[model samples]
Target: MQSSAKTIEQYLLELPEERKSVMNKLRNTILENLPNGFKEGIAYGMIGYVVPHSIYPSGYHCDPKIPLPFMSIASQKNFVALYHMGIYSKKELLDWFVSEYPKHCKTKLDMGKSCIRFKKMDDIPFELIAQLTQKVIVEDWISMYESALKR
Candidate 1:
């Protein structure tokens, strides 16, 4: 579900008690692993990491006024979701994540184009997520994003 909260702190406060801890851990994991040049804020009603205008003045092509989104973590109705644009835009990264998922979690991979759903909060693979977060630096992500936009 999309949150109406204006800030990350507010967003966390609004989460159900059951989801607070996991979401916090996920947020921390992403923050610790995310490469430099990405800023953290509330975007699309979730905790988002984006390439800010300071780094990429062109901003998001979809909406030039907004920053270029890289990743986000949200507590959806049925599950917690990690949205990583890299995996959606880069095939090699997707392949690596798919191959590595089984090694980290016993639960079958539950994923969409960019959103990885963790239905079993206990099974959320923070380590794998950390690795995935670190895989793409800002430059690489911008390059990949730009390349995709051309098509």
Candidate 2:
């Protein structure tokens, strides 16, 4: 569900009490692994990591006013979702994630093009998540995003 929170703190406070710990774990992983230049804030109603207007003045091609989004973590109605734009835009990254995640987590992955859904806390592979988050630097992400826009 989309949150009505204006800030990350507000977003955390608004989430169901049962989901706070899981969210915190995932948030911590993202924060620890997230490269410099990507700012975290509430975007599209979720906690989002984005290339701010300061770095990418063009903003998101889809919506020029909003920052260019890289990743987001959200507590959905039935599951926790981790969305990674790199995986969505890069086939090699997608392949690597799909193959390596199961090996690392030892659990079947439930994922869509860019959204990985964790139905329970144990389903999350914290280390693997960090690794994935670290794979694409802000510059690389901007390049990939710009290349996709050319298509």
Candidate 3:
């Protein structure tokens, strides 16, 4: 579910006790592994990691006022979701993640185009998520986003 919390701290505090640790671990995993040049903040009502406007001045095409969103993590009504733009835009990355998922978690991969839904929070694979976080650097994401925009 979308959150009204202003800061990541606030967001975390608002989460149910059951979700707090999991979301924190997931957030920490991403923060620790995310390549430099990406900033963390609340975006689109979730915890977002973005390529800031200072780095890519054009900002997001859909809403130029905001930074270019690369990834976000949200606690939904029934599941915790990790949204990575790279997997949606890069076919190779998608293939890699899909292939690696079963090796990491027993649950079938529950995913949308970019959103990976973790219904069974206990089975969340932090290691695989860390690897995925490191796979795309800010420069590459900017390039991929621009290329798609031109298409």
Candidate 4:
């Protein structure tokens, strides 16, 4: 199903009290774990952390204004999801996960082209995931982006 269309704050504002608390906790965990140069904002109603297009205008195959977001966090009716596009585009990273996940993670990290879903904080692999966020460097990403723009 398509994600909702509210801003991150608006989406939280609209949730019922209990879900709000849950989302808040999940949001905080994500924020606290975020690495440097990744910006957090509302995109398509989820908590999106992106390397702005201005930083990587040509990294993605799209309009320059489009963002090259590394990750997105969203809370659904029954779960929360962490969308990491790097996992799909960078096979070395995904391979790392494949080899290490069973030992480091406790739950089945669902895959979509790149999304990782969790039903609760208890289902998440906090430390390793934090490492996942740090694996890609903004400097290198910017370099790659500039290289793409030159093509």
Candidate 5:
């Protein structure tokens, strides 16, 4: 999945036709709803965004520039994935999602402890996804990162 893309736009442009459409839609949705200081780009051969360590200096996950929180969109041969790091840091948010998600849909949200996997765009709850992204505000994430520097 090594992208030929030199930039995010190139990344989007490189995707196969159908995947391009879905990924672009999702990318737009996320950009529209994203809290300030968050940004979108490519990482690990996927379409994703990272909270840069330049802002946090110590990256919210510790190790500063070595590791940072990311939300990614993966277009595999079969399915698409909307993935994020926030699910691992906050229990309240996870609890809310677990309780609310199953109440509305019969199929499970194919998510792990942190990752959310979706085969199709229609399978995702746009509002829920938006809120989940919203939960980790930039200030909070930066605070967590900056605190790591103090330790």
Candidate 6:
């Protein structure tokens, strides 16, 4: 469910008590592994990590006013969604994650191009998630984003 909450704190407050711990752990993991220059905020009604305009003044090519998104987490109706832009935009990363995730995550994998869905905390591959997040630094991502635009 897309929350109307304006801040990350408010967003978490709106989630059910049962969901809070899982979300908080995921958030902390992301924060701990996130490369420098990614800032967290409420975007599209979910908690988003982005390359701020100060670092990438061009902003998101889809919408320049918005910052360049790197990742996000959302509480959806059926599952928690972890949106990984790197995996979606890069084929090699996606292949690596898909192949490596099952080794760490015991549950059945549920994922789209960018969205990794999990019904519970146990379904999450926290270690792989952290590794994936750490793989791309802000400058590398910006270079990738810019290259894609030229194509």
- Candidate 3 structure quality by residue, lDDT tens digits, 1-151: 7999999999999999999999999999999999999999999999999999999999999999999999999999999999999999999999999999999999999999999999999999999999999999999999999999999
Estimate every model's Cα lDDT from 0 to 1: 0.96, 0.94, 0.97, 0.70, 0.70, 0.90
Would you estimate the TM-scores of all the predictions?
Answer: 0.99, 0.97, 0.99, 0.74, 0.78, 0.96
> Model 4, range 52-141, lDDT digits (tens) per residue?
766655534665555776677777666667787777666788899767777877777677777777775565676677677778777765
Candidate 3, residue 70: Cα displacement in angstroms equals 0.6
Instruction: Report the alpha-carbon TM-score of model 3 versus the true structure.
Output: 0.99
Where in model 4 is the C-alpha error above 4 Å? 1-6, 16-22, 57-60, 143-151
Candidate 6 stretches with Cα past 4 Å from truth are: none
Per-residue CA lDDT of model 6 for 37-65, tens digit only, reads 99999998999999999999989988999
lDDT of 1: 0.96
Query: Per-prediction count of colliding residue pairs?
Result: 0, 0, 1, 0, 0, 0
For model 5, where is the 10-residue window of minimal lDDT? Answer: 58-67
lDDT per residue as tens, model 5, 7-68: 78887777788788777777877887888887666677777677776655555444445436
Q: Assess candidate 6 and give its lDDT.
A: 0.90
lDDT of each residue in 25-66, candidate 2, tens digit only:
999999999999999999999999999999999999889999
User: Cα deviation of 136 in candidate 5 (Å)?
Assistant: 1.3
Better of 3 and 5 by TM-score: 3
Model 3 local distance difference test score: 0.97
Worst 10 residues of 1 by lDDT: 29-38
Question: Which candidate number has the best lDDT?
Answer: 3
Please give the RMSD of candidate 4 to the true structure: 3.3
